[model samples]
Target: MQASLFSGLPDRRERSTAHKYLAFVYCTNKEWARCDAAFDAAFDARPSFALEEYELQNTPWRDAYVKAQGKRGWQCSRPLAGQGSNNRPGQDSANPLVFSLNSTIITAITPLLPAAGGHSMALDGGSPGAFGARRPMRTENNVQLRVSPWANVTLNGKRLGVTPPLTEIKLPPGSHTIDFSNPGFETVRKTLKVEPEQSITITHDFDAR
Candidate 1:
């Protein structure tokens, strides 16, 4: 893990950033205690560390970030880095060592929207089990994917393309199945239950798997 590696690095700033990301990882998985711990580690490593304003607004782990600060008996000072409204994490390419990727962005499943610059591909196959079962057209439910190293995706035996995958996946309230497979990693199959207007985020990291 990059977090572990960064923990031992000579630079405290890098370590803090790594732990910040690790917190998001635990947050996405709903591991509350570990999430708080990772944030604590970040602040402990570099007290000057802070997140940008946009991060607090758009990221899925904002709740966890708040809880982490609450556990520390304090609140974070906003945008301590002095980054402007137009600034973003990867916008600066001046330093080769400065690339930071946030893997905790929640991904949504789709019926495959061609408008999102992704050409929707439908694989003709067997009947779509309960997933394809008829229900009200109200797309009141959503399925979000968080798969690492990516995988060939399938929903109820109907292909949904691969991870780093197609977006805008909307479905009616019900149960569905999705399968994730990679060349050497273990294939992951997930059964999702969606209620009206409910969103479920599935997290999978194919490590030694």
Candidate 2:
């Protein structure tokens, strides 16, 4: 399934995330070379990629990550005044989960969700979210979406326009409402539980009940 998720990912940053995840899996399987290659691919996708502080200090893939960074003659950059922070599980911050586009998915939010405190860049290990300077981060979860046909997406009370292009949204951790509507099909509203560092899939098939 992880391999399948990488098929049509259009964003370079998202691609780096996929590579990093694959690297972790490879290392867990003891596929040393593949693990290193995956990390390298991640770097190629995004040079600014880095492991979170927790990812650097702990986790089974730490050594592999270090080795990968060493090959490039690099070190983790320090977090600017208010730019970096920890995003551990059960926390209110996380890396956005990515969804690759395909024929079946009309509107899917795959690139990731808003950062917890600030806009965060997706990274290899736990996301020590890199806050975005422009927008304020208000959510701690990333939601992956899949809607068939086409639909007008609405989250909370705001209209998210139509699908086929809407790929990112931000929301706080907790329960939120999402509405999917198409011309001939009935509107479907779903309530979801969002958590930090956890990826949730909200799929709606207008053709089905």
Candidate 3:
């Protein structure tokens, strides 16, 4: 699909889009080199691609993007104090130059109805909010799950066939809920609104006490 898109599209903008999409695909596959190549192709066609249009916050591939750009000295300017860094996952909080965010990470309080228990679960975190109230522009609905080594993951209250340490799942775009549970760690539940062709990644860090 990526090769077809790149080969078929010769226009600069279209090619740029293809490269960005390919970067996203490669990121999901954990192929950093191919992802970097895609980013290079994307920026060659559109120099301002990252600064003006690419989304860095809550994106699963930002770490790869940052490392790729760092090799080329494409340092991203930080957004500023209390401006928008809370939501960007891969940015360094102490080093402003490596961090940025276009909007706040939206969190809402909601009750989680248990699948089989009489008790209800209280969920307190949410996905990143719309960018500037106009909805961040997106293309696909990919869900990437970064679970702890021993955590079990469930989507929309349904347990996946796998047990733990899951990576990614592609789903239809819409509202989805995720839960991460382990014996010794606190179960985490979150609600996210997914957009078309947009990849959403949720990482469950089990180190917190």
Best by TM-score: 1
Q: After TM-score superposition, what is the CA distance of residue 194 in candidate 2 from its true location, in Å?
A: 16
Give the runs in model 2 whose Cα sits over 4 Å from its true position: 1-8, 78-209
For candidate 1, what is the total of clashing residue pairs?
Answer: 5
Off by over 4 Å in 1: 1-3, 58-60, 70-74, 79-146, 149-206
Give RMSD to native, each candidate: 14.0, 16.0, 15.9
Whole-model lDDT per candidate: 0.53, 0.53, 0.49
Q: Lowest-lDDT window of 10 residues in candidate 3?
A: 106-115
lDDT of 3 by residue, 1-209 (tens): 34444655657776676576556545544466777788887777767666332255434356666666676666766442343332133535442222232222211111111122222222223523541122332422255455433345567877652212134455655787777765434677878666564555455445433
Scored against the true structure, residue 43 in model 2 reaches a CA lDDT of: 83
**Full ranking by lDDT:** 2, 1, 3
* Candidates 1 and 3, the one with greater TM-score: 1
Report the Cα lDDT for residue 35, model 3: 72
**Compared to the true structure, candidate 2 yields what TM-score?**
0.36
User: Tens-digit lDDT track for model 2 on 1-209?
Assistant: 33345435778787787677666546544567877888888887788888765344223356677677877887656332333332333446344323333322124343322111211223224433422122223343255455543356777766654443344554555777888765444678877555555444455555453
